[model samples]
Target: MQNESSGPDDIASILSNPILNTDSYKASHYLQYPPEASAMFSYIESRGGRYDRTLFFGLQMLIKEYLCRPITPAMIEQAKAFFTAHGEPFNEAGWRYIVEHHGGYLPVRIRAVPEGSVVPTHNVLVTVECDDPQVFWLASYLETMLLRVWYPITVATQSWHLRETIRGYLLKSSDDLAQLPFKLHDFGARGVSSAESAAIGGAAHLVSFMGSDTVLGVVAANHYYNETMAAFSVPAAEHSTITSWGRERETDAFRNMIARFGKPGAIVSVVSDSYDLFAALNAWGTELKQAVLDSGGTLVIRPDSGDPQTIVLQTLRALEASFGSVVNGKGRRVLNNVRVIQGDGVNPDSIEATLATMDQAGFATDNIVFGMGGALLQQINRDTQRFAMKCSAIRLGDEWHDVLKDPVTDAGKRSMKGRLTLLKNHHTGEYRTTTLPVAVEGDWEEALVTVFDSGKLLVDMSLAEIRSRAHAHEG
Candidate 1:
């Protein structure tokens, strides 16, 4: 978190030195390439896993945060000292060649499908090549850092798919899609491994929905993606705030939340299952019903534990009995002012199941919202989308040769050959991946654009722009 003005001691303490961010073996890779090799080309793709399509994102953040910075001699000295004792041959000359010639800006060119574009699996999402032949290993050396982008990309893809799932149910059971964007809220800040994960993954989820409790995510969007405000949250209570009031004073604690946050035109959430969920609901419907209705704002009830599908329906019926409900034109019942949110054990699968059950019971999808924690940000892995960056082509003595891996044991692991480019067929609206030479022969629109070039960012996309591109296919 230190600024540029921080002293060398502060900078050295941080583990983000670009040279040291890669796998240890990579330090010796420059010596492993063919002696005649002049340049190398690589591409990244989703080999195909959980989702058929993948959302391209987070590359801008990576480029700006890690690649754009100039590598210093001090960092090189530090890396050399570490690699020497670690039994790896450090490419001191190759790195100095970059500092002397390219001024330490990475001599690499990156072309990628515009961020937020949902490209089908098995197609090239990004291509990387060294801008300087002398540093042919530079592009591949960055694979460790660039490939880390898989985290944000996977989170965005999952969030988008979950949005589509919620949209379908809303169409069938709700009167309109007005509340779709706020239906899924990010509650994963506390569940993630680090602050950076919370910021990156939280920003990814915001690409689909606008409701989030992760404040750092909102800050990330504002700082990285040029958004003023990316997500919204309301004053809400947690288990501690309720339990702190003593079991006997639980009703008083509930009333205090309403009095504090339930102003007109506002929404406040309160966890009501501290002692007994049914008992609390009875109190709200009987003694506390008038106070809730007179608050002039919506009261969101939260049930932290239970089978989400069963509990959501039960909670909806209880709210109906207390505050009453009305059948909308869609023929689904909606509870007045009061609503429910299920925060525990929530994921896309659970949300789908609960909504399906509610729709079947003639209840609207708008009756409840979802608060996702660990399952939203931390549960997925790189293999969740089977993301991989591979050397597809290399240059030796001015002749470009195809470099690929096609093991018969696992054909799914086969990689592309030659320099790659992604193209979208104008007539069919389908995407195809082909060598750069072949891309010129078809009636296709280039899907991959130059996003980064030799220490410069060519495109800067905003969160609103990304959100729009991500949902463009829906229309």
Candidate 2:
């Protein structure tokens, strides 16, 4: 974890970890549209979330790892092992053919809803194309790679919703709009599925937030999006940090935090519910009031247990009574010098409730920030957005065959047919899906932008651009 290496050494060491393109199933080589047939796949649809479009991510990682490089003998050996494990025929010919035909690039044109566009449900997010009929199979091979985008996209959309929610409350309850982005802190990293998930989900949150503790998210934003620093974290204490000081000296623990991190205007958060919540509040109001006021910084008290809403309300009332309150421009009671952050049991619903309750109590929304964990990241699945990539049309022989599945049992499983075109209605600003002949011309706002083609990254989107679009609700 402490390796201080760069460039060749890091890439060499990291690349040593085997790459698994899960969707490149061992049987995919054989299952592709026959050599005699041609096909185009529309990597269509994500059916959930508040945002119309998903934050397109993970493609660069997939392309760099699997497409940019040539297939090695080691890769073929691994493929063989896969075939043996699956009890299927080894696809030496198919893979070799792929290498010979593909050279060192993915021979497909991927047009997608721009990185941060508001893509509507049932509209094509991505369309896959290849001039070579035999290359149609590559579409499914890349499914696992591209479909994985939903995780980050869904998380980004969820965070965006939370941001919007907070923004609304803040607009109504407070005058400060600039601090809205940092309202919801990302505390979900440790609760995610993996280091990669943490990086992706945490970065997604950064698209709508500026507060984060997941260092890997910083690395990911920089590495993938050309960002110098997408997020910042304040020095804060955890349960262990406070508990290590012992319950007998909890007040001292609070003092030590002020002494060390007491920079004027610098924020430091302390978990205050280690023992008796009420006692801690009493000490913070009486014993710690002078330290907090004189520290020239904001003291964020974190209550990590009990009912989140109730605890938040109690904390707010207690702090207002003890530390006193200041009336903001909105004529609301803003906690003086100190704020409470409810980190436990925080989610979109609870955050909304907490803000509403705070508003009703004549407290400004800016009086506190939110820290969310499991519900922020791992609580969602693919179905949360109903995301799926499928073949909307297939060309076989000389005819364009429209492909769709109209399941009798479920209409939601049904798909669109024929060549698909995503169009933006200029007036209503909503997206519309249409089928067009390959050479058809019409008055349409072409929605899908080419992202990757023939092993080249046609577009390298920056995190800043995506964040701007996402925040502006322009894309």
Candidate 3:
């Protein structure tokens, strides 16, 4: 977030000094890779189809952080000492050039499958290019920044998979498919590593779902993707809010929520597992039945413990016995003016299991929603989707070279080669890689677009556009 006026002779640039790896030197970068290579074309892909597709995200933030921001001379001087202390060789010449000309703009072009595209694993998600071979260190220097994208994309893919899972059950269980988008709620902000992680991971979840409690995720979506309002949250009470009122006044806590947030269309969620979930549900249906019914708004009961499938079904049964139920067109029971939200022990697999059980029990998907915390945001890693950014093609002098790594020990680690273009296999509506640089007429449309080239962001994507694009890939 700083800029430099004069060039650094002895000091290293602030941004490029701290490398994630010990041997991440621009001058001696990727020693095993081609040294004469002037241009490095690195691509990101998932090794297999663990999920439907990888969502392209977080690169906008990466570009904003490093390339677009001004690099102050003072920041570079500070990093120089840190670099020496860390024993990681810094590329002063390469960084100094960036600081001088492009205002810390990284001298690289990153073309990729658009963010929110449901790209199949083993298909190319992104490609980074460097024009000058001598200054190719900048390409490797920025690898750390780009690799951070893997987790966010993995999280997005995971969330999308769950979305499709919920979508299928919704179409079968209820006639109103509009409610499918809000079926999965995000509560993973507290479970993540940091604020930025919460934001990035949360934003990934939002690409598929509309309900979230993470404010940082809302902020991340707005700041990075340029959305006016990214996610929605209803008035909800946590354990602290309810427990603070004392155990004897538990009914009063429930009453207070109804009094404050209860309206014709306002939905309020209450966490009911502080003491007894069934007891509280009974009290709401029997003792406080009139209060909830009189509110005229939907009350979403949140069961935070026990097996989510069992707890949700029991809660629905209790609600139907007291508040009553109406049969949907799909022969599933829908509780009147009430719903259940399972926030605890909810994940992609668990959600699918819960939905399947609910369907078997003659219950509609409209009667329930899921809130995922750690599993939705924090339970993923770069390997969740096996995302790897490797140099598949290199340009040296005037001749272009195809680079690849084939290890006998692990065939999955083998990388793709040559000037790659992501093409849609028309029959499957899925993406595949091709060595052809240009799209053949009527054969395939190029999936990779010039998102960021040189010092400018070529494509400006909106979150709404991204969400539509994401859902378009749904089978």
Candidate 4:
């Protein structure tokens, strides 16, 4: 899609397009915003209404359309009034000044892993360097967008790791030739601070992995996944509850649920860990499996309690022993067809531990699935796992100043000095060292580049494309 456009004409024209109503761009909570009224007019009038197609338009769309918060007329009018009071001639430099001075654009050099590359701890994921002496003061404001981009990269990296672990288990236990049909569901909405961040977090996972259940993630993922892997699933709630009264009452309630949504051939998932997870699994496992199979449907059982490895093993064994290994006329085995999904407190460490435990217990990994919530999406986020942002070098007068933070605390937290060069190890191909200025600049290639330019995406990449890139890099 074209980058967001500036001026009332472009906004008006683009808003009229019917394609916005599609599943990808549906007006969900993350897409809804208070209408911009005289704000546009006021901003135009203050600047002599001369639209030079500024990059701010793209930034605005990211903030307003994508973020989808209350951008009230009052706020817009206030911004308009501020711009009118400080309006300058319309030009790239002038616009840069306006943004830098009032709109807050600080030139900070950011060194980050390539968008889809997997990164580890203490690995300097990004280094933001500013030429201005006072740019350090604005670091907190930049934190919002900086972390916004970085969090997804971190989450995607973790997801990639967890998926690989699962895949390895599947290869060892199940038919290698059969398609696994994997999915990564983002369940971090509750843990995230706001709807916008949650959506972005979910979108990040989808970009590096597969479909997400978060509706906001659907919108964000649509920005990259509209043409590939177009379908996804949403859970009814964070957890399942038969009700608040009694065990028999809850069972009846659950039965009523199955009766109410008795659609044949539908893929339905239910969290089965309300009161005594094992008991619920025992009670509902047989009936739910038979109901789905008998009706030509598929039942995905989600267990979100106790040890994941143990629960999954027990659940799978029960299903297989109870249902038998007979494939229906539709070529779907009743035992193999029922998927055991594990959610609640799933992270890289937990995923690895679960896989190791399952392997040790001799359980088939093919019968297991995962729905990562807080651990994958929220916990190891950029905010939690921070990359250092430091001023390594600065130009003062005629000489270049090489600055270093004196090691008064942790050595890992110490900042390096000079305009350093990151060298890739010739043998391992991993980032080796941060060398001094004496190293040849010609040998090192600039890492960060403008992926988006002139109000348009310079590079068109789908989520699958990014995942393929990540997989190739991994290999």
Highest-scoring model, lDDT: 1
The alpha-carbon root-mean-square deviation between model 3 and the true structure, to one decimal in Å, is: 3.9
Ranking according to TM-score, highest score first: 1, 3, 2, 4
Task: List, residue by residue over 204-239, the lDDT tens digit for candidate 3.
Answer: 888898889989998888888889989899999999
The TM-score values for the models, in the order shown, are 0.97, 0.91, 0.92, 0.65
Q: After superposition, which runs of candidate 4 have C-alpha atoms over 4 Å from their true positions?
A: 1-113, 119-150, 176-184, 224-231, 234-241, 244-265, 276-279, 285-289, 326-334, 381-384, 420-428, 432-446, 451-461, 473-475
TM-score of 1: 0.97
TM for candidate 3 is: 0.92
In order of listing, the candidates' clash counts read: 0, 4, 9, 1
lDDT for each residue of candidate 4 in 1-475, tens digit (9 for 90 to 100): 7656654335554333221212222112121312221000000000111111100101221322422222223333333333345542112332234244634223333343345543333333444443343332222223434434545555555566566667676666655313333545666777777777676667666644554667776676665544444337733422434545356666665565566554675666666677677676677665555665565555677777887767777777676776555433333233654667778667676677776776675555655667787776666633444433444554554355666676767664566555554454434545533534444344454433333221233344455555565666435
State the local distance difference test value for candidate 2.
0.76
After TM-score superposition, the amount by which residue 456's alpha carbon in candidate 3 deviates from its true location, in angstroms, is 0.8
Candidate-wise lDDT, in order:
0.90, 0.76, 0.80, 0.49
Q: Pick the candidate with the highest TM-score.
A: 1
Q: Write the per-residue lDDT of candidate 2 for residues 23-110, one digit (tens) a residue.
A: 3353645454555666566566775544555655545544454555665555666666666777666656656665677763557788
User: Which 10-residue window of candidate 1 scores lowest in summed lDDT?
Assistant: 5-14
Q: Which ten residues in a row have the lowest lDDT in candidate 3?
A: 15-24
